[model samples]
Target: MAMAFNSDSELFPMVNVNNAKLSIEEERRENVDEENRRKDLPINECMGEKDANLDAIIARYAETINKYNLRNLGYPTNQDFNYDKLAPLFHFHLNNAGDPFVGSSFSLNSSPFEVSVLDWFANLWNIDNSEYWGYVTTGGSEGNLHGILVGREQFPDGILYTSQESHYSIFKIARMYRMHCVKVGSLFSGEIDCVQLEASLLSHKDKPAIINLNIGTTMKGGIDDLDLVIQTLKKCGFTRDRFYIHCDGALFGIMLPFIKQALKVSFKKPIGSVTISGHKFLGCPSPCGVVITRLKYMSAISRDVGIIASRDATITGSRCGHAPIFLWYALKKRGLIGLENEVHECIMKAHYLLNLLRDAGIGAMLNEFSNIVVFERPLDDDFNRSWNLACSGNIAHVVVLQHVSVEMLDTFVHEFIEKRSIWSKDEQFKPLCIANDVGSKNCACLMHTTYHITFSFLSTFVTYPTTHSCSPPPAATSITVLRRLQPQILPPPPSSPSKDSDLTTVVLMPTLRSTTVVATVAVVAAILTLSLLGIYYLCLTLL
Candidate 1:
C-alpha cells in the first residue's frame, strides 16, 4: 500500500491500524539487504527470541502513564490525542535532515509532511510560502536557539533583552551565544515592564537590540505587548534596521491567533521571527515545535550541505521526521474552528476555577486573556504531587488545558479548601502573602487586608489621578498607592461651588459648625493612614 502525504491524505488515512504490525514469517519472506544481513548477524548470535517481559514492562508503564495523565493539571501539554491510525509510519526509519524548504537526499525521509506542517504555520502567521523559511524543531528551546541565533547573526554586537519572567531557555541561549544579556522587569500581570525596558534601552543605546518577546510567560501566562515594545524601541532611538524581535510563543502562539481581540502576531509587523511548540495546544505525542522567519534572514545562516542536498540552516541536523507527521496530523484533525472552541473552553474553565477559589476565600487570580488560574501554594507536598501542580515560590498555577475538566477542577478545589482548613489551624503556618505576585486587589493576606481597607477608606475622600487598584510592578519595589495619590486641596468658591470644588479643603465657619475641629480630625486620620501604609510597605520592601 502506498501512502500520500497531503492535506486530504492526512485528513483521511488509508492505512489499516490492525495490519500495521508485520509477522516474523512475512518479514523473513522479504529479500534482505547486505547492510540489514550484516547488522542482523551480530544481533542473532547475541540474543534469543523476543519474550513477554518487554511487553509486560510496557503495559505497566502505560498503566502508570494513564493514571498520571488524569491528574496533569499544572502543565501546558494537551493529553487528548488518538494517533493509532498513524502507527504504520513506525515501520520506516525516518529522518528529516536539513531544512524543510530544501528537499533532502535521504529517500526514506518525511520532508513532504514536514513541509506541509511548516506551510500551515507560515499561513497562520501571515507569511507567504515564498517569503518565509523554517523547520520543525525538537521543542520550544530549539526554536529559541535558532531564532536568537538569527538575531545574533544579523547584529553580532546586539544585546539580548528578555523579561525576568521569560522561559529559562532564553537566558541559556544568551549565555551559550556569549551575547550580553539584559533581564527586564515584569509587571504583576507578568507582562514585560515597558517603563523599565525604556530605561534599559536608553542606557544601552550604543549597541543594537535583540529582544525575546514572550507570547505567554511560563508561570503567569503573561503576553507582552508587542506594539508597546515597538513604540519603546523607537522612542529609545532603535531604528527598524537596528533591532530584531523574536516572539517565543511556545504555548499561546497557536491559541492567540484564534482569539478575536488578541494582539495578532503577523509577519506584517516588524518582528523578525515567531516560534510555537507543536505539543502544547495542538497536542502532539512528543515534544516538537515550529519556527518561522523571513526568507531574507536565511542568507546569514544558510550553507549548502552536499550530503543532504539541502541547506544546513536549522539549529540541529537529522531532525525528528516522526514529529512533523504527528504535528501535521494533529493540526489537520483540529481545524481553526476546533482550536478556537478548545481555547475558549480552557479559558472559561479557568474562570470557573478562579471563582471557586475566591468563593472559598482562597487568594487567587486569573489574567484577562489567559487559561492559567494562579493561587496560593498548597501546604502539603503530596497534594501538590497528586495534581502535578507547578509551584513557584508562594504561588502555584493550574494551567487549564483541554484535558482539565470542570469536574476535575471542582474535585481539586474541594480538596484544596478542606486541606487549607487543616493547614490554617496550625499557628506556625501563616497564610502566604501573594500581594506581590498577584495584585493588591487579588491578595487577601493579613497585611494586604489592612492595606486594602486603608486604601478603600482613602478612596472615599481622596480623588487619585489613576485608579486605586493597580498591580504591583516587577520586584514589588514601589508602592502604587503613593504614586497615584496626588491630593489637590480645593477651597470653596465664593459665588458658587463647581464639581471640582466638591471635595473641599476649607469652608467658612458659618457653613457648618466646628469646621476647624472636623478639619483637624481629617488631618489626623490622613497622618495615621500614611504612617500605617509606610510601615507595611517598608516591611514588604525589606522582605
Candidate 2:
C-alpha cells in the first residue's frame, strides 16, 4: 500500500481534447476574419478607386516619360502615322471568295495589294524585272528563315556559308534544316574575311553549298563588299544551280538599293535570293520582312517543297493582315524622294555623331557604305572606355544613344566623359571594350542602340533625352575641368530683370499713372453725356 502511494497524485486529470480542437478552430476563424478585413479595407473605402489609382499611376509614368527628351532612342512597336487621316479610303469587308485567303499562294501571282507594294520595292532596287516575286514575313529573321528553307529545298544536300559574325538566327535555321554551316572568320572591322571564305568554299567544292552574304553585319555595322563576294563566288566556280547565294540584307536591304543608286554602283549580279526587314530602315511596326527572288528560282523552290505546299512557305499560319497594309502605307507615305531624304538625313546625322566623337577625342569607327557607326575607348585612356566596362573591367561605361540630335549627342558625350573621369585614376576600373561586350554588360544601353534599331523596331517611337545625368559626382579634377570648360560648351541662361528703384519708377509708374488718368477722363465724359441726354428727353416730354 505504501509503495503504491502514487494515489496521492490526483490520478489522471480529465483531458479536454475537444476544447483544444475547438479553440484552434476559433483561432483559424479569427485569422480568416483578419485576412478578410484586410482585403475588404480598400474595397469598403471605394469601388472604382483601384481603377482611379491605376490611372493616376499610368498618367504619372507617361508624364515622367515625356519629361525626358526621347525622340529616337527607343524603338516603337506600333505607330499610327495619322492613319486616321486616311481612314475614309480604307475599307473592311467579309471575304466573299470561297477560299479564306484572297491572295495567291505564290508571290509571283500577285494580288492588288502585293503587286503594288512589290512594284514600288522593285523600282527602288532599279531592277527591270516586272516579274520579281517576294512575300512579306514578320521581320528579317523570319525572312531569313524562309529564305533558308527555300534554299534547303532548292539544294537538298548543300552546305551554308556565313561569317562567324552572321546573325544567330541564320545558324539556327541552318541547324533546323540539318545543313552544315561553315563559319568564316570576321575582321576586326566586323566585315567577313573574304579570303578565308573563298578558301573554305574552295575546300568544299566537292559538296554543294549556299553562301549567305550579309549586306550589313550586326556587330560593328560592317558591310560586306558585295562586288568582292560576287567575284569570289565566280572564281570559286560557284553557279546558281550547284550553289545558291542568299543575301540577308535585313538591316540594309531597304536602304542599300537607294544607296546604290545614289553612289551609281550596279547591283546587277543576279543574286539567287535576298531577304529584308521593312521594320529596320523603312520604319514599319512589327515583323514585316520581304524575301525577294528571281522568278525562276522562286518557281524551283516552290516546287521543291511539295509536301509543305508553297502557300505554307511561311513559318506561321494566318499571317497578320496589318503587316502588308502598314508596309504599303509606309512605302506610299515615304516615296522615293522621301526615302532618299531620310537615308541622307540618317547618314548625315551618323557622320555628324562620328565627327563629334572624334572631336571629343573618343575613338569611334564608321562604315563607308552605311549609316552604322561604332566607337570604343582608346586603350591608353584612363577613363572607363568600352561597352562592357562595368562587368569585364576592360572598358568604360559608355552608352550610344541613336537617332540623336546634334545637341543631344553633344550632351551625352559630355556627360559620359565626365563620368569616365571619376574612374580614370582608379587602377581597378576598365571599360567594356568591344561592341559585343557592351551588349552583354549593359542591356539598357545596348537596347538603346542596336537591338532597338535592328531587331526590336522601337527606335521610331523614342528619342534620346537632351541631358543625361549620372549618379556620383565626377572626380575633383574632372569637375574642375568641366566647370572651367562648361561655359564654352553649354549655352548661357537668360538674365533676370533689374529691380532698381529709378528704373521701376521710370518704366512702371508712368504706365500705371497714364492708365488711371485715361480711365477717369472716360468716366467723366460718359457721365456728362448721359446727364445732357436725360435733360433733353425731359424737355421734349414737357413740350
Query: Which numbered prediction scores highest in lDDT against the true structure?
Result: 1
Q: How close is candidate 2 to the true structure, as a TM-score?
A: 0.59
Q: Write the per-residue lDDT of candidate 2 for residues 491-529, one digit (tens) a residue.
A: 333255465322111122234444454355446655655
Any runs in candidate 1 off by more than 4 Å, and if so which?
Answer: 1-52, 453-543
Could you tell me which 10 consecutive residues in candidate 2 have the lowest summed lDDT? 93-102
Index of the highest-TM-score prediction:
1
lDDT for 468 (candidate 2): 19
| Alpha carbon lDDT of each predicted model | 0.83, 0.56
Count of clashing pairs, candidate 1: 0
lDDT of 1 at 224: 97
Candidate 1 lDDT by residue in tens digits, 211-315: 999999999999999999999999999999999999999999998998889889999899999999988888899999999999999999999999888888988
Error of 1 at 209 (Å): 0.6
- Note each model's CA RMSD in angstroms: 13.7, 27.5
Report the lDDT of model 1 for residue 231.
Answer: 99
